[model samples]
Target: MCSGIRTNLHFPTCWDGKNLDSPDHQSHIAYPTAGPATFDTDGGACPSTHPVKIPQLMFEVVWDTTQFNDKNLWPEDGSQPFVFSMGDTTGYGQHGDYVFGWQGTALQTAMDNACFGATCKGLTTQTTATANKCSVPKTVNENEDGWITKLPGTEA
Candidate 1:
């Protein structure tokens, strides 16, 4: 059986105090750096350049690869047998980026209230079924489902 894998991502929690966005999209935000141990472990202050403190966003994802543990599925060379959606086979190139989608001052209000979990003041919580009903316009027009011949752009 596959041992499975889990990945955790922490977003930048400091803002530039001016523009909401940067040209390349990530320059406006930075991670904390105060404690001596490490930048991420400290929960320290924002750098001088990015002084405005923002909510720290974190995501954790778990994958079940047990179905692929069969020896018949392994390549003769013994290389990895899985690939990420973006065509990353080695998995080291995995990265995440997203634009803030909170409505108006809703996010600000939550931050102001020091909200944790679903009990924050002035914040509304929804069940997973309700939240899953929401959808955004597709940025890329491509078929990303089913057992396709190959990943979207990885065809040789």
Candidate 2:
């Protein structure tokens, strides 16, 4: 029952292969056995414009916030706020495709807590300025704790 705002993430496909001088070379080179399969092919010689799949060593997550709030959360200046906790579980080669599939989960906390909070117990901090303005706990002693500590004998 987690709900706040939702968005889509896109990933660019890439290949891991050796730079070959010509396309005629098709000998199966011994690729790195540790990770995904790799081969030697002419650079940028793939016939199709679409991306080709290769050994997926890493992946990233990206998001667009344009229509997030209007979809689910309250409508504001298109600035929807929410906390996202994501991690990959499915190991490589789970899917038959050369690209590996990943399973992830995201939890939606309070809007204010997720959007403008300084410190969260189990969530990552997003904004330091918002945290400072909110007077959340400070990591350093020099930080003011929402109090004006003045000298007793100072001139009024």
Candidate 3:
């Protein structure tokens, strides 16, 4: 059986320098450009519309399918047996949202110093155990685990 699947996500880094967000939640930001010379690389510049360039946010996720490695566990027709929590079976529909949570200029200061991970001068760092102790009041009152009829916040 195959090991697993890994996906890389690169969030838009160019901001409109006006609105922090839009009705569709995407109009105010865009990916950087290299002007057709070559695919946008590390040195790519933001477009005129979104003149303010921000630090890029990237994520890497690894899905574990080892428990279902047995051929008998798969569908008889040989279709993929995985479906994302958002009901995306095609995989292409996978997406994520972001909300700025850094306190004050914490993020901006760190970015300016080229800090990677938790090495910024003024930024604070905590162990995984300490961070795990943090929690917030549940705003969405719903069953978030086990089998469910549909994903939360997705109404027809």
The C-alpha stretches of model 3 lying farther than 4 A from their native spots are: 34-43, 85-87, 125-156
Top-TM-score structure, candidate number: 3
TM-score of every candidate: 0.64, 0.17, 0.65
lDDT tens string, model 2, 1-156?
A: 233233322222232344422253322222222323223322333323223433222232234444443444533564424433222222222222123233232233423244223444445555745644654566777742222223335555
The candidates, ranked best first by TM-score, are: 3, 1, 2
Tens-digit lDDT track for model 1 on 57-134?
A: 776566777766786667679876677777777666656776679998998899889986667899898876796688
lDDT of 3 at 108: 82
Give lDDT: candidate 2, residue 146. 26
Alpha-carbon RMSD to native, per candidate: 4.7, 20.6, 5.5
Estimate, for each residue in 46-130, the C-alpha lDDT of model 3 and write its tens digit: 8999888777676656776787788877779987677777678777765667777889998888888886556768788787679
Residue 50 lDDT (model 3)? 89
Candidates 1 and 2 compared: the better one by TM-score is 1
TM-score of 2: 0.17
Error of 3 at 117 (Å): 3.8
